[model samples]
Target: MDDTGRTPVVDLRLDRAHSARIYDYLLGGRTHFAADREAAGRILAAFPAAGAAARINRDFMARATRRLAHDGMVQFLDIGTGIPTSPNLHEVAQRIRPGARVVYTDNDPIVLTHAAALLRGRPEGRTAYVEADVTRPESVLGAPRLLATLDLTRPVALSLNALLHFIGDDGADRGHAVVEHLKGALAPGSTLTITHATADFTPAAMAEVGAVYARAGTPFRLRTEAEFRRLFDGWEFIGPGVTLSHRWCPDRPGDALRATSAEAACYAAVARKP
Candidate 1:
């Protein structure tokens, strides 16, 4: 609506703190406003390692994408695709397979506003964005742009990194149900990659962090390692099964041991649909 030629379907809401923008602020990006920076300051006071956690989580996404592309998977569907950070999922995959196709879906209007950055993929490859929420898996999978960009009949690498924590369990297993629905829709041999925040490693710090997000009107639920593993039920885990974010198929020597479990505060894994 503000000159992008496409009317904004939702409000930008710069007055409120958004998880995506808070993350951008924590990562030292200039895309955040004062509200986001204020919330980020509270989060850092509660969990000083937040910036490191964000970086390591992003690094995991890159490693997982490269591995999947190297394994010959040519399509990627990244739900909760956040603000388009450099070396995005498509950038990583297309680096390995120039013709790789990627569909990035997110509920954030800011992400939708800057989607052009995400769309800039290699000429041989394709990238598309869907302004949809992850809770509504049908809308994401059935989106016209998503369908046109990637062939669902083929193996696709699906990533839900650092996203599930925002979806409260609500005592009905809603989070797990959402994942199962998405998993069922994918073809056999497709891979599911996830990096989720957990309280298992540092319960007190994570609890404080959760309180901060809650006060900001965002639901935050840090899961246990068992709960995280259950999200991948019925799938075959790849090598180095279910480790800290920095430990999952680390790309460098000593990388796995670099961050303490409490500092990482997140669990990550890659599994095959088989």
Candidate 2:
């Protein structure tokens, strides 16, 4: 916590809790601190299957990216891009198309610190990082790197995976202001991919779980189908609409259904801009 009142991307607050680090730990990454691991363990003690859930979400990301790159012919704007997890959106997209472009944005300084790995994309393609808040869609859109990645006038896939819940409204519109603003910027054929937490199932455990994050200042916002869908008012949901993370084009059998309660409470969806 220096002049920025925060750790340099890598200056992790091991003593405090953080969603990104907790997510890293759950994903079996070694960049987290002991405290992060402990916090994640406590979360697992409650849900008992958080790690697997996180993996499922990551897998959904891969499936969605593959679908986009194979034919979308657009760049990617991956906001809330977590730490340098393998098979990152860019990696998956670039794999399918040698020169796919990706622009990742996150508020975590740790992400900025470890971004060297995130930046190592195919030479023919482009990869860049922007340290900014997802709520500030303007700054994110204005980043020079993002401008360099692709033509904004063309269709783009905006990956807001596990991001919108963290952004809410006080007395604003039904959907967060930023989301509307973001969607306004996308081209007609662009896509919006999302994975959000829900309390549609497992209310008790999910409530307690939400409390844990709130107390740690890493609060959670569990949305309903209608409320979540409102974020994409003009966009058309792809086949299957909004479902659980595991159900979003899952790769393996027995992995294509979303959990509907605290015993299961994650939602995933991909939609196209009309």
Candidate 3:
């Protein structure tokens, strides 16, 4: 254990080829194995901009959280919460709204292993970490431990960031099902913040990236803009709906349109409950 009452979280046998660790490597994180690094390197070699795309996705998370905290009073439910990246959802939200409450969920055992970092929150705010799968929403919301920290009576901002690709697009593995369930459970004024990788901009690179994930046991599936918009069917999308991650309400004007091709591969939008 590394003083967090949890194990050091380095497992090689089960699967050194996990999406979380691969992403960790891409983002210059130190929690990846040689195999994961190799995969990430191959992807980066294919698209030299993959690292920048990862950074843009990370920026999207921060930007979306800023929107939630300043413009809305809703709590947050962040699923597919990856490794403990700095300025995480809770950190961003709580910084803006000191009383903001956040609940994080991730099925990855590695994420669970490092969850201790997620529990840290502003003294005035609330944060809780739950080890659960997005494919099973009931198990998450119904978990007594998490429900205690988050109040379901009001709105909650549900974030699905760079995670949908991991969910198979078939009948049972469909990620839309997970979104439907969570959106169904939220109250009015709630918001859904989603950012997904797409092949609309870079077909060849996207194909190769998908293949890399496939070989690593985490095949990526790109969703079209229309299919992604369906995720917010009932919600009232804020201005600039279903736009590129770099286009979604940047800190200032004129930034979105000039976004690079790599960053544009990811579609990001935030919609509020009507």
Candidate maximizing TM-score: 1
Q: Which 10-residue window of candidate 1 scores lowest in summed lDDT?
A: 1-10
lDDT per residue for candidate 2 within 198-256, as digits (tens), equals 77776666777677687677757778878887777878887688777777666676665
lDDT of 1 by residue, 14-33 (tens): 88898999988877787899
Clash counts for the predictions, in order = 0, 9, 0
Q: Report lDDT per candidate.
A: 0.89, 0.79, 0.83
Superposing all C-alpha atoms, what RMSD in Å does each candidate have to the true structure?
A: 2.0, 3.3, 2.9
Find the candidate with the highest lDDT and give its number: 1
In model 1, the runs with Cα more than 4 Å from the true position are 1-6
Clashing pairs in 2: 9-109, 9-110, 201-260, 201-261, 201-262, 202-261, 202-262, 244-258, 247-256
User: Which model, 1 or 3, shows the larger TM-score?
Assistant: 1
**Ten contiguous residues minimizing lDDT sum, candidate 2:** 1-10
Indicate whether candidate 2 or candidate 3 has the larger TM-score. 3
Order of all candidates by lDDT, from best down to worst? Answer: 1, 3, 2
